[model samples]
Target: MKHIAKVVELVESKKDDYIALANDIWSLAEMRYAEFESAERHASAIEAAGFTVTRGVAGMPTAFMAQAGRGGPVIGFLGEYDALAGLNQESGATACRPAADAANGNGHGCGHHLLGTASHLAAVVARDYFAAHGIEATVRFYGCPAEEAAAGKTFMARAGLFDDLDVALCWHPSVANSVFMNATLANVQAYFRFHGKASHAALAPHLGRSALDAAELMNIGVNYLREHMPDQARVHFAYINSGGISTNVVPAHAETLYTIRARTSPEAIDLFERVKQIAEGAALMTGTRVEMVFDKACSNVLHNDTLDAVLDRNMHAIGGMNVTANEVAFATEIQKTINPDDLANASRHFAAALRDPRPIIPEILPYRPDVERPVTGSTDVGDVSWAAPTTQCLTACYAWGTGFHSWQMVSQGKLSLAHKGMLLAAKTLAATGIDLVGQPATLRAAREELHRKRGLKPYQCPIPGDVTPPPARAAGTPAARASQDVIA
Candidate 1:
């Protein structure tokens, strides 16, 4: 409780500094694995806050770590700075106008700029609290980049970065403040490249074996297998490479980047095995050999009730963001720009499920009960959760149901509403860190729950074989697989 008050005061005093950091990151809006400026900014801020900064851990140039305080219960806060593509827009208004110099490119459409800032603020506050109160604990800010597709967390987990953590706390920018208590599906990604002899369609059509056919058949196989899979399993695929220019030319090469997801890692592995068999069958039928490159993968979240309770306490302690008149007016104007059907469905859903009916504005979330809504997405955070005791919270930083990669979210990265949400998150995480340091029984109970959920099964990466990290073309290495987890 004392630590919560201390963190509130610290955050209030450093509000301008935190806002500048968040705004700077919002202005940069760099894409995954290339958030150079954003990473530097966060590292600089952490250094200024008196934390020892370690840069480029786990082979990621932008990935870094900042630590403060002596050891006790080591607490880690997750931060991301990656932006979305093709969403460059002014911070206010609905039009897709670009900021003067950087036009029509990447922007912080998912509010990760705020995410990093809040995490950093929480870390700074926790560090200050330890200094003032002599609470024995280590505060760490994980400078995670490329959350959009380049799963930096997976590599960090694999490299034993988080294995020493007693408890890990993370939060995301969303439509409301709530302690997330559901499970995300485990997922794997791969690129199936098919090769065949190239030939002119008019003259040597018989000599060419179309690689595109293999890609199409593989997709078909996956689509048909969906019916046979468990109800919980989710299969998604997209065509990233078609290997051709014209209809007259017989394409010799093609690629299908597929992602297989399931309720858990073991289940996902089984499903991926079947998918690999189907790919082989597709290749056999098409008379083309295929090269399968393992991309990136992560496990599903194993919900922890004990840690969820701690997060709930923090969520209550920090309180929620009540929208004001100006906030409401801006939200209404933004609502007018969206598709009417989307607005109607979202309003209907929120009204039925939440206390509010207004689209782009979700209701206040309480401490307990699993959110009835489905997460529908996966993250490498699941891997870390499996390895250690972890709890995640969601702060309403954007408009309700704004969805990911939308101009609506980009418009609110660090505006007052987003800042309020981030401040709440900082308080929640900093307080949670305090609680973990002060309460050993809570940590023990959280670990027990994690063990019960996992049972005897060990954690496994959904990416089978040796999936190399994708090479950052901007970084200038021949594009490896470091950030290849993104299938979309």
Candidate 2:
């Protein structure tokens, strides 16, 4: 308890510094693997804080690791700092207003700005605790980028970055504060390209074999597969390229990005195979050739009750966030921007835990036992769980009804309420890391639980060996190209 209190006080003293860093990251608003400035800011801060920094790790320019102390019981903290595309909203505005520069601009709508900062702050506090107590435990901070579109941690996992970790801790900014007992879906993202001969539509219509036709037919075929797939399985697609705008000419090439998700990696692979078959049939019917370019994939998260209990204990010991009256007023205004139906749905969803309707959540929810609830969404953290025992918690950073990946979330990202929540999350994670370091028996129990659950099934990276991380969009590199000639 004394050590935990010291950690909490340390995080409290540095709250303003981290909040400023979060604001800086929010303003930069870099997306995906191109987060050079955002990553550098974090790396520089931790480097000055006494942690040795290693940059350009795992074949990623923005991916890096910072470490302190030495020896066994290595506890790692995962941080993300990628912004979503087209969510740029004016900061601190209650109304929907895009940034003046562009109608669709990038912003930290998913709260990764705070997400990355809180984790790093926790690692710093843990490192300070280790130095103060003369503890010989190792603490690491992972600067993971491109979590929005690309599975950065999945790529790092394949590179064996997390293999030496005894346990890992992470957190996300959300509407409620609680440990995640639910597991996220495993998914694969890819681009399906179709190529064919081009010809003048009005003059040589018969000579043209339209690739656009093949893309459309492929989408229809996959839609029909919905009924045959398991209820938990999901398939989605977006037309990345549809030949050209000239209707007078028959298109020669078209492409659609597809994402297939299922409860497990094997299930996702099975569904992906079925989708490929459908693409072949579409190409055969349209006289066009099809190519599958593998982008990336991530496995489902493996939950550990032993690790969850540690986080829950730390969270209770730290207590709830101290939100100010002005912060509450700001949150109340943000809540007004939400749709009536959304507010109603949120009320119904959290009715069991929340007794009264409020703009900001004022209490920490109890940790519920794992019921295997379906998360439906995907994250790169799932891959880290497979590499080492991992557990994550959520903090009340946004208004109760504020949906994620929206302008509303972007607006409140740097507010006082959000800062308070971020500080509390840092305390929670720092305390958890301290506990895991001091209690070697707890780490043993956690590792044994992870082993028992895994049994004979060992982890295999979901991404293929041939695939590499995508280059920045400005660099003009295609996400993935066919390894072999098109199957015809």
Instruction: Please report, in order, the local distance difference test score of every candidate based on alpha carbons.
Output: 0.77, 0.86
Candidate 2 lDDT, tens digit per residue, 1-488? 66677987899899889999999999888888889999999999999999999998887899999999998689899999999887889988999888675423788999999999999999999988888888898999999988986899998999998988999999999887878666688998888899988999999989999999999999999999999987678999988899999999899999998999998888999999999999999999999999888888988888888999999988988888777888889889988889988876664433135667688886788887734353547888999998898988888999898887899999999888788789888999999989888888989898888888778466689988877887656322345442433555
Off by over 4 Å in 1: 340-352, 359-363, 370-373, 456-458, 474-479, 482-488
What is candidate 1's lDDT per residue for 130-183, written digit by digit as tens? 888877888899998777755778878777788788888888887767776555
In candidate 2, position 228 carries an lDDT of: 93
User: Candidate 2's C-alpha lDDT?
Assistant: 0.86
Instruction: Tell me the lDDT of candidate 1.
Output: 0.77
Task: State the displacement of the C-alpha of residue 200, model 2, in Å, after optimal TM-score superposition.
Answer: 2.0
State candidate 2's TM-score: 0.95
> What are the TM-scores, per candidate, against the unseen true structure?
0.92, 0.95
